[model samples]
Target: MAFTVKINNLSKELTLFLNWLFSIDIQANMPGKSRTFRCKTVKFWSIWPLPPKVEEVHDVVYLDGIYLARNLCVLICCNDTHVLGWYVCRYEHAKALFNVKTMDQAFIWINELSAWRMTYSDFLREMTVDEFENKCFTHERLLKAESSIWRMIRQQTLFTFLEYIDITVPTTNNRIEGGVNAQLRSMLRAHRGLTLERRLKAVY
Candidate 1:
């Protein structure tokens, strides 16, 4: 048992199989513990296994928009405009977009950036080719920066809060995030020398 203190080391395949087994077990139980699996299953699974696949596809997808908005606020507050000039004259806009006060406002601002009609694409098209070329280095870099979030929004249900007005995400709360961080630290402290692969098994 990789989770047991008696075990000195765990192979990658064992970690993958265990993570998958636990995930399936958790899903089936739905907010409660499932019957503990048998050791015999582990022996059987270890012989021939499905290839381990790690997909971070929708991992913390909403956090992308949150992080981007926070970073924009940081850049706006900075004195050096040369570093982030596109946001230079847009301090108020940036503040409103970041909207730390209200979750709904923050969600709206992120959507505005990648919205169909007033999309980032429209921002590019409005500029003369020469001006666009001039802004290529800085502006294009900024554009490319959030391209992934926009892409994710298109594919995922990032706007679920629209239907459920009462939903509050964890990142917005320092208390919950700190508690999670502290738990992680305690885990690492108690189990010194835990590899990233093993740590990720707990996450999976």
Candidate 2:
């Protein structure tokens, strides 16, 4: 329901459950990484349930929550960086280590960042250590940032696509409109012998 809308006929409850399950599976599969299962499962819990005083008693109640957050963040960052490294690495053997995420939609974000002067540390600052090490553990925050990055990637891809086609994605197309009008006028003069009704039908 969250990703597909209501088209899938899945309820919000079901969607939330599935999303939680997927996160669990993703964390479970990561290797060479350590995550506190308490944090992992707590990371999947509803954000609204977290009281404002969570910071005071966090150690007492949310040990697993902290681990969950850190694990999810590692995966997200690693997966994203892996995708980026693919397009950048030229070595045939090194290229094998890069994943497909860098070759497709997500690559646009990675490539744009690569060309720009912004450092990975700069991007990490936007996430903030607290956000990265903790906030990324939650489903809601993760999905929000994921969507934001994806949109940036998509916009860059469209701009590149327009450039390749040699057609400016104009803010306004008055020039195109005038060109179409000129074509119709010239065509009409050449076929003035035809009735207006026939001209309209032919144009259509």
lDDT against the true structure, each candidate: 0.39, 0.35
lDDT of 2: 0.35
For model 2 the local lDDT of residue 69 reads 20
The TM-score measured for candidate 1 stands at 0.26
Off by over 4 Å in 1: 1-145, 152-156, 166-178, 186-204
Residue pairs in collision within model 2? 38-64, 39-64, 39-65, 39-68, 40-68, 69-137, 83-102
- Cα TM-score per model: 0.26, 0.17
Candidate 1, residues 79-197, lDDT tens digits: the string is 11111111212122334434434556656766666474355465654533464465333356456646765775767544444555465444443432344334444554544443543
Tell me the TM-score of model 2.
Answer: 0.17
